[model samples]
Target: MSLGAERRHIRDVTAWQPRVPGVVEVFHAHYTEYAYPMHVHDAWTLLVVDDGAVRYDLDRHEHGTPHGTVTLLPPHVPHNGEPVTEAGFRKRVLYLEPGALDTSLIGAAVDEPDLRDPLLRRRVGQLHTALAHPGDELEAESRLVLVRERLRHHLRPRPVRQPHPDERPLARRLRELLDERTAQGVTLGEAAALVHAHPAHLVRAFSTAFGIAPHQYLMSRRVEHARRLLLAGQPPGEVAALSGFYDQAHLTRHFKRWVGVPPGRYARTSASLT
Candidate 1:
């Protein structure tokens, strides 16, 4: 939703628990005039404001979330928030499990909860987008690990080195796994365990080797399978299930993305020529 024009003061909130591990919940909100009373949560609150801003008191200290800022409220901290301007605020949030970040860093997070990292802000937004999709668990999990690592870096600075280690074998093994399970996709965690590599590393290896991410590779496989099924005169609804899509809508989305036409249109158009 765009914040280009002023929107009415109606509380809008979306919350869900994704299948990805370590993330307890995803919460998104847009409020014009509402104010939050002092409360505490059992999970760590990671927030980013997309429009307007938020002014909050965390642990008796005042903090504000301006645009381009990533906010972290440690678990068990008492906080209260309200809009920073008349325009109110639109924000995306992630509630991570307590263990996602070590307890030792809680003090650092409480000391300085707001981070002004542009890359981190962008990655968090992408992570939210990935989490919104139902069948993109692997992409969500991959982004989550990177976001978590970046959060840790802010709490405790570390040197990041880019390595070019050979990972072709690992990448090939992952391709084989994807090919075998195209009808029923595998989770990043499962692929990592089966391939004996770290989840993030596995994703990196696959992308580096194949020029596409693992989830994208699987989706392309499914889309191609759907194409073949459609050419065989199979109905779009049945092709969706047979090709490992969540439903017909999901099939149409990926199919159109790859083929430049929806399943029904493609089937009918090709048949008309024959």
Candidate 2:
């Protein structure tokens, strides 16, 4: 049986609220003649299309979402979704907390950057099945662990260097420093010193090349590191220390703002799956 199509268009915060705790709210949305304007959320939004095509713009990047494909949005990033066909778009969205991913067996698996893995796809399918049937929390959680493991393994590959002809030597060094010190923390002054440039010049040049301020880019890297640690079952306090946040509360505030959930919840849900 198919979940009935919901045609409402959500354009404001009042139209959205947090779904049930621990459970990923699944919805089959049909945009026959409507679209969702730019908005942001506080949870992981996983969109899996089953029919038609959906065009989404996230952080200035445009994507054409097709059937059998998934799109993941980390919280608070502005995005807009629209149908590419007159037939409109039909898709399932799964809203999950970080804690819903914790499983000792799959702990490492969920830590990967990329979430698109065959195993993860299967697990997402299982989650859809579980949502279709109520009162099967145990089975749902079990499948969640399997999906987490596959995602972790698939994401554990080493970073690949993409060719960049426009990258200057100093800019490249700055990028490297950001990556290396993301978990360790680096101040603007410190980064500027590394490249022998003044802080103001560095800031302007970095922003020109990356389209975001240097400090913002640094914060994003730190958050990315924190996310991996949290997914790997690390405590918020520890992740804060490692990721250069001043304290657990600081990390919590930013993590929630960006990821749409606190570290504790992410850790707990991940742990429950094991």
Against the true structure, whose TM-score is highest? 1
The global Cα lDDT (0 to 1) of model 2 is 0.59
Off-target runs (Cα >4 Å) in candidate 1 are: 1-7, 157-274
Encode model 2's per-residue lDDT on 37-87: one tens digit a residue.
454443566667767888867655677765565566554344567779867
Question: Mind giving the per-residue lDDT tens digits that candidate 1 earns over 1-274?
Answer: 6564436556555555677888876767677766765545557889999999999887567999877999998875556688888778889888888898888887788788999999999899999998888888899999989998999888963232222458878987998899899899999999999999999999999766644677877886687567657766789999999999999999998775554456887677435533
Clashes (N, CA, C under 3 Å) per candidate: 0, 11
Model 2 alpha-carbon drift over 4 Å, by segment: 1-60, 64-68, 71-167
The lDDT values for all models are 0.79, 0.59
